[model samples]
Target: MSIFKDFLLKFRESFKGTKPVIHSVLGNVFSMRVIGNKTHGDLAEIALTEYINEFVEDYSAVHTGKEKFRAKKFEEDISVTNKLTGATFPISIKTYGVGPLQLSTNKDGSMFSHLTEIVSKSEITNSQKIKDILKNPCFFNFSKVNVLPLIYDEKNKTFKIILFDLEKAYNSVSKVTYFPPRKYGKDRETFPIYKFFTADEQYIFEVRYGGAGANALQRGMWTHTENASPFFNEILNGTYQINEPLIKLVSKILVSPREKHEKILDLLRQLNGNS
Candidate 1:
């Protein structure tokens, strides 16, 4: 009997004999089906798909086209700019959800070390050109890097940015990689199944599972954005033009709901008719 077959046999016997044997055959079977054959590529595709779906659902629920705001990361705020009167008000969008795993391997350290070596050489030689090259975003590259800066728009006098954190994100899924069994013995091709010990000897199987690695967090964030970009562009840019007049109306309605309700309603009706 093969090692796997023997393992199954033992598991089957355990379930047959006693009621309190803590039968895990079903659990083991289910685990194997889901994670047993997964590859790194498979997990990545799944993660990316889920990240996009969740982002779109969450974003639409919170942002209604009625508000005119620009998102900015540098100052950590979304600013509503009044186009008509040229006034600006700061606003913020907060997202709560599951975040990705944060892990790093030796490979990441090696790349960083190499870049540091180059930077050190450039500094010692007093090469301003080399230093400038090193300072460029493309030159100082990594597998995962986050550049979140407050962008200034002097033309419009507005800043907009979004901050999102996923809720219960990790528990979304589990995965494992697959590996074939190894062969040994003189007649490995025809080795008897019973050669695998059953009675006294115990066997163990260890499988590495989960997309747990460095850059997982950044990858997850990228996945979410890639999924959401289409919808955001469509709704914000394509469907509705967020202008100064809209921002002022939204701000007024927020402060004076009773007085502005009818006027706001009228404006929306007209806007809809134009559309």
Candidate 2:
């Protein structure tokens, strides 16, 4: 059996902690329908985290939060803990099904890319959860982290990512996040009145930090994502708009040439063995 399949098949047996719903994207196709509804997202998540814990020096996998957060702990889509520096941050993945919308504001001359969120409520309210972590001394192990953003295109099968220093970005650009909280029954119209993420400045972001060869926002090792349009800060007075599109980006991950899957499987095994 392929290493990926071996790990996945052993997922329930090896890791019996959290349950992140699996999803995937193989080249152009968003998600490949195998069983009823299962993809490599969750499986990859666990395998990657385990690999991080095992092989990736200076970093550990932190997918869950404090106990009080309750159902909110699992809000994190991807988090990396710097074992050496004792820092950690999360990468928030946002999907746009109908591609991305370019909104030009009439009030102010500004062009913003708008997208709908196809994730859980906790995904948006992560700031509150982060706030909780920031307050807890236990999380001091992860003293620093960048709240990175990844934009996945559903129709076009592409991704536009923004890697910003959450602290600096917040202080510099004007930001506006409105994904509702996890407090049950919060409809689409429900706005996150509490703490959220947006920009406060318009400075140029030094996109100097280039690709991780692999982006773990698959967010860790053995992962090289495709169809991505990564951007750093550009001169901007207007903000990027976000709205619910008819089609959301919630596709699955599927690779072609079959061997690609085997390659990932091999990488996973190598990492697992190292860990």
Give the top-scoring candidate (lDDT).
Answer: 2
1-275: candidate 1 lDDT, tens digit per residue:
32222322332343343342122211221122223333222222232223222322211111212123223312112223333344433322221111211211122233233334443222222345334433444323321222111111223433222221211111121211123224667645221110111122221111111122334222111212322222111111001122345345445667886757877668866975632
Expressed as tens digits, the lDDT of each residue in 151-172 for candidate 2 is 3444444444333323343333
Off by over 4 Å in 2: 1-44, 47-57, 65-79, 85-145, 165-275
**Residue 245 lDDT in model 2?**
30
- Candidate 1: misplaced stretches above 4 Å? 1-242
Clash totals for all candidate models = 17, 22
TM-score of each: 0.18, 0.31
